[model samples]
Target: MSRRPDPTRRSEQSRQAIVSAAVDLCVEIGYAATTIEAIAARAGVGKQTIYRWWPSKAAVLLEHMTRVRETQIGFPDTGDLRVDLLAQTSAVQGLFASDTGAVWRGLLIAALSDDVAADGVRTLLQAAVVEAKGRLATAQKTGELRADVDLDMVVEIIYGPLYHAWLLTGRPLPEAYMEEVLSSVFDGLRP
Candidate 1:
């Protein structure tokens, strides 16, 4: 007799298949066109299987992005605030220049219309903000930034314009612009 397949392994396979299908469909059809039905058909899974594992297509696509792309930002601690900000912005610039950025653009567009998708996007961004906040606090402690500097405001000041360009203007986040951003933001924060 053939050995029984492990239920856990089977479940994981199904989960991955669903995620992969969701991403592929989103990429091929655009986020607005990709549906749970299409993802199920593409993944060779039943509708219930996807509904059981994810609340919505947005949720699945959110997981897909997290698993399929390296969206995590590692804030460098070069001791110089300008250096660290440049590295962080450079990484953001590189991400926006890649295929993953196309997916992100789709996701953001979907989020604008879908509240569930908006929440998912907010959650992902909030997690990154939490991580970046720690680094900013460290910089403040080290006297690189003024003790009175508001870390939250500092983060927004540093990254908000890049996101604005990414989301609205559809412009590239170039190194020169990143340097200009840092120079402007840091000018106010000097200890």
Candidate 2:
């Protein structure tokens, strides 16, 4: 006689399928068109299965993004602020160009009209910002950055152009894009 299969393991598999289907749908179609029914169909599960775990598609996507952050997107500390900043920004640039980036862009648009999504997006973005500020605060404490400056503005100054170029201008980014931005920020804009 055989024992019963673990229901929790099967549930975890369903959850992963739902998440993967949502990510693919968001990337293939836009977020507005990717509905819970579609995700259920693509995932080979019922809408109730998804709703059991997440209230909406946005929540499903948010879980995937959170996993990526916790497992993959840690800000590094190599004892050099500049090196760490470059590494952090470059990783972001890479994310913004990948499949995960597509889902993230979709989430941003979804957040505009969705109260639930807006809160989740804010949480995800703020977590990243807080991680960045921790590093920046360390730099300030060690005297690498000025004591009289706001780390918030410092983060904006460092990332503003990258977001502008990627999300607005649609310009092509070279592999050394973050390196150039770091050089300009640290070495001054004027030659």
Number of the top candidate by TM-score?
Answer: 2
Query: What TM-score number comes out for model 2?
Result: 0.95
Cα displacement (angstroms), candidate 2, residue 16, comes to: 0.5
Clashes of 1: 0
**For candidate 2, what is the lDDT?**
0.89
lDDT of 1 by residue, 12-42 (tens): 9999999889878777787778888999999
Off by over 4 Å in 1: 68-71
| Candidate 2 lDDT over residue span 74-183, tens digit each | 78989888899888899889998889988888888889999878999999989999999999888778878777677788888899989888888777788899998888
**lDDT, candidate 1, residue 63?**
84
Candidate 1 Cα deviation (angstroms), residue 101: 2.4
